[model samples]
Target: MEWDLKVIDELPDYMKMAFLILYNFTNEMVFNDEMKRGDVPTSIQCYMHDTGISEDEAREHIKHLISESWKEMNNENGDHNSSFSKEFVHVCKNLGRASQFIYQYGDGHASQNTLSKDRIFKIIINPFPYKL
Candidate 1:
């Protein structure tokens, strides 16, 4: 039961989270054990992309990016559109997360911000393992 996009914005933050969890409740709760496979929290990944300097701090503000795109991941495919597969939400989330990561440091989208560019390059390009 999806509501209008604008209506979600009007909802309190907790309700916003409820909407998401309820939307994909069946997505298995994943944890790292022996199998080494799990559901990546792309929402949090996207949040980190927006503002995480290290892996320690992570976060989700995806709606505005694709204009109420949470609909695309409703565990069902559509005409000329594909479902995000509750657990994987796939490349659409990837693109949105990329956007979050790129712009997390304040308008770093164009790569004009030297500090942001360097941060991006260091974390993504010249990367080494993060310890904490």
Candidate 2:
């Protein structure tokens, strides 16, 4: 699609952090995008630098980000643009739901316990055993 990532640079560091949460989730679902350049520590430092917030404030901001991201991903609750297909909307919601679990434990992904390849396979490839 020749997408331009430069657009993401326009966002404030905290927002960029929030967007990365969704982006990382979506990228896991739909791979082959541009590789991430910066490390998590660098991103977090930028966020704190731009916001001038302490760790407690950062924690609250993270909570708010997670909530807002979930609402934004939801079709009925979010920006329900009619041009998007039902399946596409479902994928968006799925991304949010999956990330909600992943972020439940503080930065749980780095452990590689929750965000494992096997789990991705389960989410993408495994079909529910339903019968008519």
Candidate 3:
């Protein structure tokens, strides 16, 4: 789905800043993953370019958004509605765990020079030489 910029523009400045931070952070993650360069400076530059905000402002807002997201995720863990099955909840937890492992040291999943590459190789390329 595409984002409606019109709706986003209607938000208050603080809310707009938060949304911009989140959007730029997501873009940074994707770009870094694809480029195999966990370059925070590039991401910050992108945020500044897109939001017309100072680097300090972008950094502060991005950090705030990240902190808020973690708090929300922590609160939601194991507290889903009845519509979500146990298996689905388990999968969600596993996804979060995998994301944490992969990004624990920058864009490790994308950069071959990082420890993530070795971990990924062990997990996907050189699995245990035994039948499950």
Candidate 4:
């Protein structure tokens, strides 16, 4: 898959690495069609397990990137500084296990009922503009 990333180098070091891994996994999974294979592991989950990041950390990182990308894409044209949060979300939903789970559950899933919609709404709508 050819990457046309214009702002990758601008990403924070850790985030850049994470995004690369996520992108690679997304490509591999899509090309291999592994999701159709029963019991096949998603790339995002495999990456977290291999990297030894807690599940929560992996999920948080993926979500953060998605939020940032969305913010950037929705901003006015020529805003190169816009966050690439949507791109991140796109990558994760395409390859990450957490995203897979979310899709599987959908909006009406009881599993998500434990989370407060108010809190999640805030996170989804308001991503930190810059990584600290």
Candidate 5:
């Protein structure tokens, strides 16, 4: 299920959906082996556009996720790692698949305008190695 819909339904409606976006963003970046230490503004925009949320909310949510995770990843002396929550990663993988499907065959539906432009640029600049 989409993280936004799931989080919205599972958590209290008043709860911010940005948390879901941040969770997915951080999980995706780490899982995909990206070097970026934190979520990017472009990624935030994509998540917000996809879920119909606000930019500030998205940034706040990402900060919340990263801050909490940092607490666990850091040692007493304040060290870090290329680590993340497994449960959140699983949720993000599922969310990524759902989002990909929507983008590939959304047919100009709700997600048409919500597609990630940054990702599109990356794809264009560095096309995938193989044809599927």
Candidate 6:
């Protein structure tokens, strides 16, 4: 079955653009497994185009929102123990770190055009010549 953007269109006009940007960003972060380093600028431009805000204002707001998200991630990774298993928490933290590493230079994983490609090839595509 084909997916649709109709649900997005159903949103109120004032919120549709912001929601679209968020949805795109989240999809890139989760499904793409990589993010272009230019995401912030792109997001700022998107917001400015959508809201008629100045570039500077859009950039400031986007950066502040990103900073807030980082703070939330940090809080989740903090030493406070919760009902979750320590291993699960560690995995979540490592996933965040791995995402940062993958996107450190560019959209390595999604584009398959960076050092990530080489690493993936070595680990998954090619195996040791000798059997265990």
Top TM-score: which candidate number?
Answer: 3
TM-score per candidate, chains pooled = 0.29, 0.48, 0.51, 0.31, 0.27, 0.44
Error of 5 at 82 (Å): 14
Pairs of residues clashing in candidate 2: none
Residues 29-129 of candidate 1: C-alpha lDDT, one tens digit per residue: 11112124343444444465677643334311333433344444333232234333433434433444454455445333333456667767776797886
Off by over 4 Å in 1: 1-67, 70-89, 106-115, 129-132
**lDDT per model vs. reference:** 0.41, 0.48, 0.56, 0.47, 0.44, 0.51
In model 6, the runs with Cα more than 4 Å from the true position are 1-45, 55-57, 77-83, 109-132
Could you tell me the TM-score of candidate 2? Answer: 0.48
Q: What digit string (tens of lDDT, one per residue) describes model 3 on residues 1-132? A: 134557777753334444554454454455545445544445556678899998678767666766665555445545344465666655654554455565555445444556766666676789677777
lDDT of 6 by residue, 1-132 (tens): 122467867743323333444443444333323234433335556677899998678767765775555555555543444565667666655554455554444344446556766655554578456677
Model 6 deviation from the true structure expressed as Cα RMSD, one decimal place: 9.2
List candidate 2 segments past 4 Å from native.
1-43, 75-81, 102-109, 112-132
C-alpha RMSD by candidate, in order: 16.6, 8.1, 7.5, 13.0, 13.5, 9.2
**What ranking of all candidate models by lDDT puts the best one first?**
3, 6, 2, 4, 5, 1
Model 4 over residues 96-130: C-alpha lDDT tens digits? 33433333322222234434343444446564557
Report the Cα lDDT for residue 43, model 5: 53
In terms of lDDT, model 1 sits at: 0.41
| Model 1 root mean square deviation, Cα atoms | 16.6
* Candidate 5 lDDT over residue span 1-132, tens digit each: 234435456542112233443454444333222324343345556667788887678767656765554343332221134254555544543443444443442223222343544455445555566677
What's the best-to-worst order under TM-score?
3, 2, 6, 4, 1, 5
Clashing pairs counted in every model: 3, 0, 0, 7, 0, 0
Best by lDDT: 3
Q: Return the clash pairs for model 1, or none.
A: 47-59, 49-101, 50-104
